[model samples]
Each structure stands twice: as structure tokens, then as C-alpha cells.
Target: MKLVSYKLKQKPSTLRVGFVMDDKIIDVQEAFLQLPGHSTEMEYMLPSEPNAFYKIGIPAIEKAKKAYTYVMENQVEEISFHRDEVYVATPIPEPSKIICVGKNYAEHAAEMKSEVPDYPVLFAKFANALVGPEDQIVKNSKTNKLDYEVELTVIIGKEASNVTQEDALNYVAGYTIGNDGSARDLQKRTPQWLQGKSLDNSTPVGPWIVTADEVGDPSNLDIHSRVNGELRQSSNTSKLIFDIPYLISFISSLMTLKPGDMILTGTPDGVGFALNPPQFLKGGDKVQLEIEKIGRMENEVIEGEFHY
Candidate 1:
């Protein structure tokens, strides 16, 4: 099942959670209300926010699955919205921690001229950097070397601490696409990459999350990125130096992994910075990313500095 967080055009401020079925988004809360057994308490089970939605744990997934199945089999039309009628937000709009792994792909590590680490290299982005499929990535005047990193993002489903790599996948809610937008100049200027990595509204995170059960064996999917329709990166998750399970186990040993937290599994070779003449994103350039089975997301790059 494809899970989404969206806002209706008529109620722009109100966030709603739903499931995608045949390109139509079925509102989970509304679907619940349509069911005969639904109670006022069911409303609490389905929050408008994705972060809280996951905090409910396995029952959240089960309820969403039931609603999605019911909507499909019963032809429930009133609660479903067409793709263009709603604003799609990031699957986890306010992730507690957006943990990013650097140099996870061997080719990407080579292009950056960095040694392959025996341990995972992790960094972070905050909620401020998160944007949805409908948003624009602002290219500020302060940074001249903007780059894109397309990664297979893992969304944690439940609280996990000191779990084994073998048992790590059990904690995953699903997968989504993440564009790790970076300010190359700012990144290279300091040993710590926080300034370059977490620019506000720079990263575009989701079209929606494809539930883990629906996306089995994520270790070998095709992943690619295009800038202005020109393919810049083409690779596979099979190339990941530190796979999802290991990363979860390694990170969980140090910090608790909670529901709605994200892990960006790093990008492949062919970033703009590695080009002979770097091709940083400019105003109006569209960055398109696709990971097989998870779907695609495109965002426009707007010129000028962001205010506030």
C-alpha cells in the first residue's frame, strides 16, 4: 500500500493522511468514518500528520491496509481524491531525525576522493529542510555550488534500540525517495557538513511512502536521477556499502530509532561536482528522481535567495 500525507485545495491548512489506489488518494480518516464499525476513537487512530500516524505502531498499518482494501473492493468514491486535486506532502513531513549516510556507494566515494569507511558515515537534516513533491527547491545567491544526491530513504516504523542487523528490517515502516540537496562550497569549507547539508527547503523528500510489505528485497532496485531531463546518475541499491539493515542496527546502538525517523542511504556516482565543468542547479532547472517500484518525484529550482 502507498501511504501519503496531503492537503485538499479547499482546506489548505488541514493535513490529511491517505493511501494511493489507482492514482486516486483515498483519505484514511474519511474512509474510517465510512466504515460501519468506526467510532469517534478511530479518529484518534488516524492522525492528519504522518509522524503521529506512525507513532500508533502496527495497528496504524493494519488500519490503513483495511481502509485501502475496503475502498477498493467497495468502490468508495466520496472519500477519494484525484491526483491533481490535492497537495502531496513528504511521507514523513516532520521526521524526528533525518539521518543521512555519506559515501555509501563505492563509486560515489571514489568520485569524492574519500576512503571507504569501515563504519557508516552519518549526518543529519532537520524538518526545516523537508519539502514535498509540490514544492520548489530554492537556490540561494549565497551558495554557488548546489548539487543533488538521489537516495533510497528508509522510514522507521517503531522504536528500536540495539537491534541486530538481521532483525532491523522489522522496524521499517516503508521506503521513499530523498534528494539530498547539498551546497558544495559550504560543505567543502568546513570539516563538519551541517551548513551545506541542511539548507532550508532545499531537499525534496517524497511523492509517498511505499509500505515495506509491498516493497520486498529493497537491496537491488534501480535508482536514477535527471537534471533538466538529462540523466546525471544511474545506479542500483545493490551498490550500497552499508545496507539498510546494518545501518539501522549500527545507528540504533547509539541512538533510539523512532517511528517516522528517516535514513538517507546515500547517492550514487555522477553528482554535478564530479563533472569536468560542474553543473550546479540553477533557477528553473527541474530535478527528477526515480527508484523502481517506489515511483518518481520532480521539483523546480527557483532563483534568488530565500527570505526568512
Candidate 2:
């Protein structure tokens, strides 16, 4: 199932939770209401936001599946909307923590002139940096060297602490595409990288989240990036220095991972800053990222003021 957080284009003020079926989006709450035996109590069970939907666990997913099945079988059109009728937002807009991995690809580490790390190199991004696929990636005044890193982001399904590598994938809800926007100049200025990595509205996260069942093998998938129609990065997830299971176990050992928490499993090579002449994103540059099973994100870099 491809779960989405969206808003009707005409009613953009309120956020809605839904799932993609063919080219149409099915409103979860609306569809659930149409179910033959749905009760008032069940109405409260469904959430209007993706974050809350994920927190409800398998029961919520089961209810959504039932709703989709019933709606499709009975040919319900009142609860369905065309893809263009709604604005798709980040699958988890306000993840509790946006934990990111750095230098998880050997080639990426080599290009940056950094050694391959023995452990997963971790960092964090706050909600302020989050942006949907339709939003522009802001080129703020803080730095001139804006760069892009395309990463396959994992969304946690349940609370996990001290989980083993074997059971790690069970805690993952789905996968989505993420562009870790970085201000290269500011990143190198200090030993810590949080300042450059968390610029407001810079990280373009998702169009939707493809459930883990659909994305069978996350470790062996194609990943790529392009800047204004020109391909810049192309690599496979097979080269990940720390695979998904290892990363989950490693990260969970440090702190608890809750539902809707994001884990960006590092970017592959061919980033803007690693080019021979060091190409960096400028105003009006369009950035696109794609992962095999997940979907693509096309975002433009625009000269904009930071929203305080």
C-alpha cells in the first residue's frame, strides 16, 4: 500500500490521510465511514494525519485495507479523488526525529576524502527542515555552497529499543525518497554538521511512503539523482556500508525509535560538491531524486528568505 499525507488542492488548509490506488487517492476516513459495519468508535480510530496513522500500528493498517477493499468492490467514487486533485505532502511531516547517516557508502566517503567509518555516522534534522515534494528547496542566505544528497529514508512503524539486527526490519513501516540538502561551507566550519543540514524547507522528503511488503528488498535497489534534467548521481543500494538491519540495530541501541521517525540511510556518490570543479546548487536549479521501489521527488531550488 502506498500511504500518503495530503490536502485537497481546493482545501489546502487541512491535512488528510489517504492511500494511492491506481491514479486515484482514497481518503482513509471517508472510505472507512462507508464500510458496512463501521461504528462511531471506529471513526475515531482512524487518523487524519500520517504520523498518527502510523502510530496506530497494524490495526490501523488492517482497517485501511478493509476500507480500500470495500470501496473498490462497491465502486465508491464519492471518497476518491484524482491524483492532481490533492496536494501530496511528506509521508511523515513531523517525524519525532529525522536521524541521518553519513559516509555509509564507501565511494561517497572516498569522494569526500573521508575514511570509511567502522560505525554508522549519525546526525539529525528537525521538523523545520521538512518539505513536501511539491514545495521548493529554499536556497537561504546563510551559505553559498548548497548541495544535494539523495537518500533512501526508512520510516519506523513501532517503538523499538535495543532491537537486534535480525528483528530490525520488522519495526520499519515503509520507505521514501529523501534529499538531504546541505550547506557545504557551513558544514565544514564546525566539527558538528547540524547547522548546515537543517536549513528550513531545504530537505524535500516524499510524495508517499511505499509499504515494506511492496518494497521487498530495500538493500538491492537502484538509486539516482539529477539536477535540472542532467543526471548527477547514479548508484545502487548494494554498496551500503551499513545495511538497513545493521543501521536499525545500531541506532536503536542509542535511543528509542518511535513511529514516524525517519532514518536516512546515507547518500551514494556523485553529489554536487564532490565534482571536479565542485558544482553547487544555485537559485532556480531543479533537483530530482528516485529510488527503485519508492517514487521520485522533483524539487526546485529557489532564492528565498528563511521563515523564522
Candidate 3:
């Protein structure tokens, strides 16, 4: 099931499961309102917590499905919503911390002239960096070299600590596309990449979260980035030196991972920095990050004045 957080006309945003029926998004909440005993279930399921969807939302959806199935059999009022009319928010909009893996791909490591760590090289982006699909990524003049890194993001489902590689997948709730937008100049000035990576609204995260069951074998998908309709980074998760399970276990050993915490599995080669005359993102540029099965995320780059 493809789950999304969205806002409908004049309504506050809420978590919803999306289904493509007749090429329109089936508004699960709207359909649920028309069902008997759904109100109670919705109240119990719908919460601000990221893990609530798995704990309560899925079960509620299952119950609603039976009602929806019956309604379909009887041909009740058609439930459909136009895609453009709805506003999509991040699947887990307010993650506690966005943990990212650096140099997980050998080619990416080589391009940056860094040694591939035997263990995962972890960094973090605060919640302020998070943005959803269709959101604008501001390009401030303070940083001249803006780059994009397309990565597979893992959303944690349960609280985990000291997890083994074998049991790591169990804690993952779903997967989403992450663009680790970087300020190349600032990133290179310091050994730590935090300042360059954690800029406000730098992380363009989600269109939807494809459940782990739906996106089996996370390392086998294609991940790529396109700037202004031109493909720049094209590679597969198979090229990742450290796969998802190892990443989760490695990080979990250092710190506990709670629901809503995201782990960016790292980007592939072909970043603008690797180019001879390095093509960096400028104002008015559009970036598209696509991960197979998880869908694509597009964002516009707007020029902004530097502050501080």
C-alpha cells in the first residue's frame, strides 16, 4: 500500500493510504467517513505519530477495505480525487533526525577522493531540512556550488537498539526517495559535511512511502537524479557498498533508532562535483529524484538572498 500525508480542500493534513483507481487517487478518509463504525477506528488510528500508520492506520484500512469492497459491489457513490487538487506532505514529515550514509557507493567515494569506510559513515540533517515532493528548494547565493545526491531513504518502524544485520529489516517500516542536496563549497571546507548538507529545506524527501513488503529487497532498485530534465546521476542501489541491513545494524549499535527516524542509504556516482567543469544547481533549476518502486520527487530551485 502506498501511504501519504496530505491535505484536502479546507481540511487539516492527515495521513492517508493512496490507491490509484481509474487514474484518480481514492481518498481513503472520505470513503471511510461513509462507512459504519469507521469514525471510531479513524480516531484511534489517525495521530501525529509516524508509526501510528503501521500500528493503527493499516488495521483501520483493512476494516475500511471490507466496507469499501461491499460499497463497490453495490455501486455506491464513486470515490475519487484529482491528484492536482490534493497537497502531498512528507510521508514522515517530522522525523526525529535524518541520518545519512556518506560514501556508501564506491564510485561516489572515488569521485570525492575519500576512502570507503569499513563501517557506515553516518551524518545527520535536522528536521528543519525536511520538505515534500513539489516543494521548492531555495538556492541562496551564499553557496555557489549546489549539488544533488539521490538516495534511498529508510523509515524506521519500531524502536531498535543493537539490532543485528539479520533482524534489521524487521524494524524498517517503508522506503522513500531522498535528495541529499549539498552546498559543495561549505561541505569541502570541513571534514564534517553537516553544514553543507543540513541547510533548511535541503532534504526533498517524499511523494509516498512504499511499505517494506511492497518494496522487497531495497538494494535492487534503480536510483537516479535529473536536473532540469537532464539525467545527471544514474545508478542502482545494487552498487551500494554497504546495503540497507548492514547500515541499520551498524547505526543502531551506536544509537537507538525510533519510529520516524530516516536513514539515507547514500547516493550513486555522477554528482555535479565529479564533472570536469562541474555543473552545479543554480537558481531556476528543477531537480527530479527517482527511485524505482518508490516513485519520483520534483522540486524547483528559487534564488534567495544570503542571511548571516
Candidate 4:
């Protein structure tokens, strides 16, 4: 099953959690209420915020799945919505932690003139950097080099610490698309990538989350990115230097991997900074990223203002 976070045009400030199937969005709360022998107080069983819903662990997923089943069986239309009638937001918009993997792809490592590390090279992005597929990547004038890196991000489903690679997949909620937007000049200006990578509105996280059951194997999936419909980076997740299971195990060893934590598996080669003449993103540029099983993300760049 696919799940999404959306905002109706009328209710722009409130983010609504939804269950998406066949391009339709089902309000998880409303759908749950329609189930036979349902309780009104049980509405609290589901949270409007994606991260909070995830924090409840398996119950959250089961609630949506049950709702989906009821909707399909009863053919309910009142609880359903057309996909385009709302604005999509990042699936886990307020994740507890946003851990990123750098140079997890060998070619991406080569293009950046960096060596593959023995362990996962990790970094962080905050909630403020998060944007949805429909949101614009604000072109901040602080730096001139803007780049895109399409990554298949893992969403944590359970609390895990020091788990073995064999058991790591058990704790994964599912997978989704992520664009690790960066400002190269700022990145190179200092060793800490937070300034370059964590700019506000830079990271476009999702159209929705495809549950692990639906996605099956997280490895060996086809992932690609494009600029204005022209393909820029194309590769399979098989090329990841550190695959999902290993990443989870390794990262968990350091800190507990709780539900709602996002782990970006890193990007492949063909980023703009590694081009022939180095093509950086400018206003009006459209970036698109797609992953097999998971959905696609298409966002445009617009010049943002500074009120200093």
C-alpha cells in the first residue's frame, strides 16, 4: 500500500495523512471510521502527522491497510479523493532524524573526487530543509553552485540497535524518493557539509511512501533523475556501495533506529557539478527523480528573496 501526506488547496496549513491506491487518496481517519465495528475514540489510533503515525509502528500501517481493505470492499466514495485535488507533502515531513549517506555509490564518489570509505559516510539534514514534490527548490543567492542528487531513502519502521544485517530489513517501514539538493561551493568551502546540504527547502522528500511489503526487495531497483525530461542520472540500487541492510545495521549500531527516521542511501553519478562544464541549477530548472516501485518527484527551482 502507498501512503501520502497532503494539503487541500483550502486547508493549506494543515497536513492530512492519506492512504493512496491507484492514484486516489483516502483520508486514513475517515476511512478507518467507515470500518465495521469501528470506534470514534479510536480515531486517536491514527495521527494526522506522518512521523507521529510512523512512531506508532506496525499499528499505524495496519490501520491504513484495514482502511484500504474496507474502502475497496464497500466501494465508499465519500472517504476518497482524487490524487490531483490536493498538494502532496513529504511522507515523513517531521522525521525525528534525517541521516544521510554520502558517496555510497562508487561512481558518485569518483565524480566528487572522493574515495569510497570503509564505513558509511554520514551527514544530517533537518526538518526545515524538507519539501514536497510540488514545492519549489528556492534558489538561495548565498551560493552559485546548486546541484541535485537522487537517492532511494529508507524509512524506519521499528526501534533497532546493534541489529545484524540479516535482521535489518525487518525494521524498515519502506522506501521513497529523495533529492539531496546541495550548494557545491559552500560544501567545498568547509569540511562540514551541513551548511551546503541543509539549506531550507533544498531537500524534496516524497510523493508518498510505498510500504516494504509492496516494494519487496529494496536492492537492485532502477533509479534515475532528469532535468526537464532529459535523463541525467540512471542507475540501479544494486550499485550502492553500502546496501540498505548493511546501512541499517551499521547506522543502528551507533544510535537507535526508531520509526520515522530517514536514511538516505546516497546518489549515483551524473550530478551537475561533475558535468563537462559543470551545469548548476538556475531559476526555472525542473528536476525529476524516479525509483522503481516508489513514486516520482518533480520540482522546479525559483529564485527566493532574502529580507535582510
Candidate 5:
């Protein structure tokens, strides 16, 4: 099911959780309200935490499904929503930390004249950088060489520590598209890429999160990025030097990964930095990132005068 967080016209201040059915959202709460005694379970699952669903939402959904099924059987209400009316938020907004992988793709490593690391190259972005799919990515004056890195980001489903590669995926809640927008000049100025990467509104994520069951074999998906209408990067996740399972296990070994924490699996070759003249993003450029099965994110670049 394509689970999403959105604000309805009736409740603009609060986010509502629901499954995307056709065009209309299958209001999970409304569905439960129609149920006999599952209202408490719905309340328990209403916390903004995405992992709560696994602990409470799923079971509640299962029970509610029975009633919904009956409703469907009886033709109580059709499952359709008008796509244009709802304001969509990140499937999990305000995640604690956005962990990102650097140069996990072999060709990407080669393009930057770096060796494919035997271990995963981990970095992080602050939560303030997180924005939903349609949000604008600000290009500040400090960054003349703005670039886009299309990546497959994994959303953690539960708190994890010392997980094994074999059991790593079990900790994953789902997957989403992550555009690791970077200021190449700033990134290279310091050994740490944090400054260039963690700029506000840098990480444009979502369209929506697809559950792990729906995105089986995460490494097999096609990941690509385009500027305006031109394709700049196209590669499969299979080219990843460090796959999802390894990343989860590796990161978990070092620190605990809580639910809503995300991991960007790195980008493919063909970043603007690899070009002879380095194609950087300017104000008004549209960046489109598409990951097979996950979804697509289209962001417009706007100039921000302040530079740090």
C-alpha cells in the first residue's frame, strides 16, 4: 500500500495518515471511527512516528480492514480521492537525522577519482534540510556549483543496534527518493562535506514512502536524475558498492538507528562535478529525480542571497 501523510482541507493544521487508494486517501482514522472498538488502537497509532504503525498501526489497520472490507462489500463509500485537493507531506516528516552514503556507486567513485571504499562512506544531513518532493531547493550565493545526487534512501522502521547484514532489512520501514543536493565548492573546501550538504532545504525527499514488501530487493531498482528535461545520471541500484543491508548493519554497529531515521544510499555516476566544465545548478533550474518503484521528486532552484 502507498501510505502517505497529508493535510485535508478540513484539517489544514494537522497531518492525517492514510493509504493512497486510487485518487482519494483511505482515511485510516475515519475508517477506524466506523469500526466498533478499534478507536483506541487508532489513537495509539496517531503519533507522528512512522514506526508506531508497525507496533500499532498495522494491527489496527488489519482489524480496521475487516470493517472496511465489509463496507466495501456493502458499497458504503467508494475508494477514490481527488489528487489535486490534498497537501502531501513527507511520508515521515522531521526525521531525527538523515544519514547519507557517499560514493557508494563504483562508477561514481571512479568519476571523482576515488577508490570504491571497502566500507560504506557515511555522512549526515540535519533534519532542517528535509523537504517534501515538491518543495524548492534554495541555491545560495556561497554555492555556485550546486549539484544533485539521486539516491535511494531507506527509512528505519525500528530502533536497531548491532544488526547483522542478514537481518538488517527487517529494521527498514520502507524506501523513498532522496535528492542529495550539494554545493560542490563548499563541499570540497572542507574535508567534511557536511557544510555543503546540510544547507537548509538541501535534502528534498519523498513523493511518498513505499513499504519494504513493495520494494523487494532494493538493489535492483533504477535510479536517475535530470536537470530541466535533460538526463544527467542513469544507473541501477545494483551498481552500489555498498548495498542496503550492509549499510544498515554497518551503521547500526556504530550507533542506534531509531524509527524515522533515513539513510541515503548514495548517488550514481554523472554528477555535474564529473563533467569537464562541471554543470552546476542556477536559479530557476528544475531537478527531477526518479527511482524505480519508490517515486519521483521535482524541485525548482531559487537563489538565496545569504551565504555562510
Candidate 6:
């Protein structure tokens, strides 16, 4: 099942959760109310927040699946909400942690001229960096160089610590696409990339989350990016130096991976910085990141610095 955090266009400022079946978006809350067994307790049980929704685990998935199936088979008219009628938010809008891997792709490692490490290189982005797919990526006036890294993001389904690589897949809630936007100048300024990598509104995640079962093999999928309609990065997850299972095991060993937490598997090569003479983003540049079987996330760069 594909799950999404969204709100109706009429209530763009509010957040709701849903999933897509085609061009239509089935609002989970609304669908649940229409389901046969729904009650006051069931209403209370339904997760309205994206992060809280995943806490219930597979049962929530099962509920959505049953509701969606019922809606399709019996309550077709009730789906008055269309995909165009709602705004999609970052799938895990307030995930407790947004951990990311760097240079996990071999070609990416070679492009950056960095050694392929035996271990996964991890970094983080807080809630400030997270934005919905449709949100504008702000270009700060502090520096000129901005870049995009397309990555396959994993969302943890349960609490885990020191999980074995062989059983790592069991802990995954699902998958989504992530655009690891960076401030190139700030990143190169220091050894620790936090400043450049975690700028406000820098990360664009979603369209929606595709449940792990549907994605099957996360390590082998087509991933690509297009900046302003021009193809920039095109590679497969098969090129990943440290695949999902290993990364999950490694990361969980260091800290507990909680439900709704995210792990960005890392970007493939072809980042703007590695190009001949380099290419950086400017205001109005549109970026599109696509991962096979998941979906495409498109966002545009907006001019000027962000202010509180």
C-alpha cells in the first residue's frame, strides 16, 4: 500500500494522511469512517499525524488496505476527493530522526574522489530541513552554489537496535524518495557537512511512501534526477556500495531506529559539483527525483533568503 501525508487544497495549511490507487487519493480517515467496523474507538485509534500513523504498524496498513478495497468495491461515490484536490506533505513530516548516508553509491564515491569506506558514512537533517514535494526549496543569499542528490529513503516500521542484517528488512515500514539538497559552499567549508547539508527547506521527501512489501528488492531499482527538465543524475540502486539491509544493521547498532525514523540510502553520482566546471542551482530551477516503483518528487528553487 502507498501511504501519503496530505491535506485538502481547501485546507492546505492542515495535514492529513492518505494513499493513492490511481489518480485518486483515498483519505484514510475519511475511508475509515466509511468502513463497516469503524467505531468511536476506531476513530480514536486512527492516526491523523504522519509520524503517529506508523506507530500502529502493519495493522494500520491492513486497515488502509481493507478500507481502500472497500472504497473501490462499494463506496466509489464517497471518494469525492481527487488527487488534485489535496496537497501532499512530506510522508514522515516530523520523523524523530532524519539520518542520511553519504557516498553509498560507488560511482558517487569515485566522482567525489573519496575512498569507498568499509562502513556507511552517516549524517543528519532535522525537522527544519524537511519539506513536502510541492514546497519551494529556498535559496539562501549566503552563497551561490546549491546542488541536488537523489536518494531512496527508508522509513523504519518499528523500534530496533542491533538488528541483524539478515532480519533488517523486517524493520522497514516502507520507502520514499528524498532530494538531499545541499549548499555547496557551506559543505566544502568544513569537514562536517551538517551546515551545508541541512539547510532549512533543503530536503524534499515524498509524493508518498510505498510499503516495503511492494518495493520487493530495494537494492535494485532505477533512480534518477532531472534539473529544470534536463537529465542530470541517472543510476540504479544496484550501484549502492552499502545496500539497505547492511546500512540498517549498521545504523541500528549505533542507535535505536524508531518507527517513523528515516534513513536516506545515499545519492548516486552526477551531482552538480562533480560536473565539468560544475553546475549549481539558482532561483527557479526545478528539480525532479524519481525512483522505480515508488514515485517522482518535483520541487523548484525559490529566490531570496529564508527568514523566521
The best candidate by lDDT is 2
lDDT of 6 by residue, 1-308 (tens): 78988888775356767878777787787787787766868554577677778776666776777777888788565654687888888887788888999989888899999999888999999988888887888887876899999999998988889999999999997999999988989998989999998888888898799998899989889999999999999999988988999999999999999888899999999999999989999988999999999989899998776732
Per-candidate local distance difference test: 0.89, 0.89, 0.78, 0.88, 0.78, 0.86
Candidate 6 wrongly placed segments (more than 4 Å): 11-13, 42-44
lDDT of 3 by residue, 1-308 (tens): 56666666556765565443434566555555556565565454334334355444334435445545655566545666677767776676667768999999999999988888888888989877777886788776678998899999998877889999999998887898999989999888988889999887767888877778789989799888999999988899999999999989989989998777889889999999998889998888999999999888899887784222
lDDT (10s digit) by residue, model 1, range 61-113:
87788777777889999888998888888777787889999999999999999
How much does each candidate deviate from the true structure in C-alpha RMSD? 1.5, 1.5, 3.4, 1.8, 3.2, 1.7
In candidate 5, what residue range of length 10 has the lowest lDDT sum? 48-57
The TM-score values for the models, in the order shown, are: 0.96, 0.96, 0.86, 0.96, 0.88, 0.95
Pairs that collide, model 6: none
Q: List model 2 lDDT by residue over 18-112, tens digit each.
A: 98889999999889889876688845558867777877655676778788788888989888899999898877878888999999999999999
Cα deviation of 131, candidate 2, in Å: 0.4
Q: After superposition, how far is residue 238 of candidate 6 from its true place, in Å?
A: 1.0
The total number of steric clashes, by the backbone 3 Å criterion, in model 3 comes to: 0
Residue 124 shift from truth in candidate 3, angstroms: 0.3
> In model 2, which regions exceed 4 Å deviation?
42-44, 306-308
lDDT tens digits by residue: candidate 4, 7-43: 7765445777898867688888788888888766855
Stronger candidate by lDDT (3 vs 4)? 4
Q: Which 10-residue window in model 4 sums to the lowest lDDT?
A: 299-308
Question: What is the Å distance of residue 252 in model 6 from its true position?
Answer: 0.5
Alpha-carbon shift of residue 233 in model 2 (angstroms): 1.0
Determine which window of 10 residues in candidate 1 has minimal summed lDDT.
Answer: 41-50
TM-score of 5: 0.88
